[model samples]
Target: MMDKMMATLLESLHEATQRLEQAVAVKESNPDDWLAILDEREELIHQMQERFSAGSVLTEAQRVQLTQIYEVNQRLIPLIEGCKQGVQQQLNNLHRSKLAMNSYNEAGPNGYGAFFDRKK
Candidate 1:
């Protein structure tokens, strides 16, 4: 029974990893679509956490697969970080441009001023 549970969890983990990788690729071209992938990944993670909390024993093969998953995650971390940084940079640029436009659009001292009666 434990072996079967472990196998199922392992399969889910593999599927999540594959989906995440696909998301990473799609993120550059179609970021909106990537959001749905992230949602699915989040749910898979929750399910995996529940299984771990249930304290199921695993066979040696399952342990090896888990280790492989860990290794794959290690590789994925940097790619995800790069994607995050790119998104942040885009946001910063957008904010700066918005500020610049607001400054340009502001009504700057129309010809008549409070000081007009005081001096040349």
Candidate 2:
């Protein structure tokens, strides 16, 4: 039974890492992917909680590996949050840049050459 539990945890760990990698991959492409990663992270935590409740019967190796995962995730969640913030900031900056360029065009030059001439 303990071995089974350990196996489950190991499997969960593997799946969680894969999910994390996927999240990172799609992070720049879509916000939905990041949200999915958050969900997966929660699921992984819940699995750990369930296993912990079942018993402290984990093998030394399992325990060590689990502890490492826990620590790594403790750092990783913050990094993910930072990534999300960065994506948001980049989107906002792009929007603002577009708006500024539009306003500049409306005010005078409608073309890049015209704007460059005005700048000189």
Candidate 3:
């Protein structure tokens, strides 16, 4: 019974990771979807931890599955980081553009009066 429960949790974790991988593959995937998958995986990990703490032993097959999951996670790190950098770059560009627009607005016709004295 414990073994079956562990197996089911591991399978769910595996599927979650695969879904995350697919989400990452898309250039325009939503970060929320990635977060959702990570949340599901976290829950599975917690459940598995509880089972292990309750004295469940891992079968060889379960160990292999865990190893594969770890590898997939390792591969995902760089891709996720790349996505993060891309998002950060976009934000930076947006901030710069906003600043430019603000400067332009401030320098319009209203700003020129400040450079000259009305008494002159």
Candidate 4:
């Protein structure tokens, strides 16, 4: 029984992680889709949390399996955080690029001297 519960909890955790990843992907591809994914992710995470808490009653083997899950999650969390940061950085860079492109477009290619001009 406890083994089955632990398995279910692990599966839930995996699903939640997948949902989170999908949300990140959707946000990158289509910003408007992010809200929906966020909603789903929240729901899945809540479910996973409930099951994980209940998994405290697991037996020795199940406990070991749970510990392994924890270790894997610990390793994965930093990578996930890094991925999120990378995505945010990419978005920031893209925004800056767009702004720079617009500014240059407005100023014309010959406007390079605008920066070096000594006139106040």
- Candidate RMSDs in Å, in order, are 5.8, 5.1, 4.7, 6.6
Consecutive 10-residue window with the lowest summed lDDT within model 3: 111-120
Error of model 2, residue 76, in angstroms:
3.3
lDDT of 3 by residue, 5-53 (tens): 9999999999999899999999899999999999999999999999999
Q: Going through the candidates in order, what is the number of backbone clashes in each? A: 0, 0, 0, 0
Of candidates 4 and 1, the better by TM-score: 1
Q: What's the true lDDT of residue 97 in model 2? A: 100
* Candidate 4 minimal-lDDT segment of 10 residues: 111-120
Please give the CA lDDT of all the candidate structures. Answer: 0.71, 0.69, 0.88, 0.60
Candidate 2 lDDT by residue in tens digits, 95-119: 9999988766667544545444354
Candidate 1: where are CA atoms >4 Å away? 26-42, 108-120
> Which candidate achieves the best lDDT against the true structure?
3
Q: Residue-wise lDDT of candidate 4 within 1-120, one digit each (tens)?
A: 455654675566556555545555443455445446456646755765776676645567656755765665576566557766887999999999999777655653455455432322
Give per-model TM-scores: 0.70, 0.54, 0.86, 0.50
TM-score of 3: 0.86
- Tell me the lDDT of candidate 4: 0.60
* Winner on TM-score (2 vs 3): 3
Off by over 4 Å in 4: 1-56, 108-120
